[model samples]
Target: MPELALKKETGLKKETRSEELLQLVVFQLGEEEFGLDIMQVQEIIRIPEITRIPHSPDYVKGVINLRGKIITVINLDTRFGMEQKVHDDNSRIIVAEVDENVVGMVVDSVSEVLRLPLSTVEPVPEIISTKINANYLKGVGKLEDRMLILLDITKVIMEDAPSKVAYC
Candidate 1:
């Protein structure tokens, strides 16, 4: 009876630990995979015609009207200094809330919703090199086959205060 109680207690602890997992919306940007906290993502939609804003920052792709809400769109490729690629059928806009502002991030494609244990995430290694600015990275998530670059969406969207997109 004591051994049975111990097993039950161990199972409960395991369940509690699993609850610490980070749920992410994973997407592809060029050849690399990136993830954003799922809580920040409002929705994912197919790419729509975007209205360009003249004199906007180079990284700003422009704005899209999402059900009467004008959401500013940022091209992650341009923002990360990667070669821009033409949008295709797989291209998607991830609508996420950052710094109290809702914005759309254009990605090559959205892969899947992944739940990774917090223990699997590691701080950015000093030896690792990448095109993305370190300040925009939260951490690197290790998976069985590949690693996922976890982006700090707040830093990516709000880095330039003066150039912050104003939504109506």
Candidate 2:
């Protein structure tokens, strides 16, 4: 019957779509674990010598010359309203490309690459902390005992980041 054929086609389409999985680059920010789309990340590099820019935003740590290309580096901890700590051996800069901008995000450390089903991700709740700009979140992904907070790279870099400098 036509109905049976249509149902089979629809089921096939659903299976095809469901097969697409999200690949995340996991990292640690203080005690919390966060993830970003691996496709958005160009590469991860050690904390290089950063040249501070005059009159730059508080969250903007400065610019770094990676290999030969200069890239703007943002302090993720400060941007999230977390306490600023001195960079250590574990510190790393995740070079991310969102839209036309290629910037380095300084995180405490890099963890691992996670591949999970898209269905496991859930949108953030209405009640969230003001410290972190919730509008920039993709969702929280549940995987066994791990709860990963997925951040929207575009929104976080383009929208939530403070444009003004913080006067010390």
- Candidate with top TM-score is 1
Runs of candidate 2 with Cα error greater than 4 angstroms are 1-18, 160-168
lDDT (Cα, tens digit) per residue for candidate 1, span 57-82:
88889999899988999999999999
Looking at candidate 2, the ten consecutive residues that score lowest on lDDT are 159-168
lDDT of 2 by residue, 43-141 (tens): 999998999998777789998888888788989998889998799999999999877678899999998998978988889888876588887788999
User: How big is the positional error of residue 137 in model 2, measured in Å on the Cα after superposition?
Assistant: 0.4
What pairs collide in candidate 1?
none
Clash totals, every prediction = 0, 0
